[model samples]
Target: MRDVAGSWKDLTDDANFMAGTLTGQVRDIAFVTTAVATGDLSKKVMMDMCGELLKLKDSISFARSDRERPLDVEPVGGGGTDAV
Candidate 1:
């Protein structure tokens, strides 16, 4: 009975630790994405993620880069060089 109690305690401790880590990571991701939504492209999701989380991070990065890209525009009079 003592050994079973110890094992259960160990399992609960590990589960709590994992939950805390996941929560923090999610919070960081939310912070960065919220900043991006507000037009703050300077913010980045710096946390390393795996699987679906990695895909989400990549998507956020792509959104920021897309906004950072310069648009090419032609001169109004057509007599000047194109503007970048």
Candidate 2:
């Protein structure tokens, strides 16, 4: 019937929209990752993606925070190691 065809078309359209959104998100994340790998740690991902894509965004945020944190401590005054 005509109604069935219309419903199917609508379903396919929704699927296409979701797929495109997911693809774009994935590519965005990939670019962020590449940038991070190339010593650019300031990049972050923030968006209202669906399902696990949201989790991926959250993980990327955490990674950025961790990367930005100072991991080394320099000795105070003079060129010498701290008395440990």
Which is the leading candidate under lDDT?
1
**Model 1: CA > 4 A from native:** 1-6, 79-84
Give the whole-model CA lDDT for all candidates, comma-separated: 0.84, 0.81
C-alpha lDDT of residue 78 in model 1: 75
Q: Which tens-of-lDDT digit does each residue in 1-84 have in candidate 2?
A: 244567798988888898898888998899888888899997777546867888888888788889899878766754585554
Report the CA-based lDDT of candidate 2 relative to the real structure: 0.81
lDDT over C-alpha atoms for residue 19 of model 1: 84
lDDT of 1 by residue, 1-84 (tens): 144567798988888888887787799899998998888889998877888888988988898899999998865857685655
Error of 1 at 3 (Å): 11
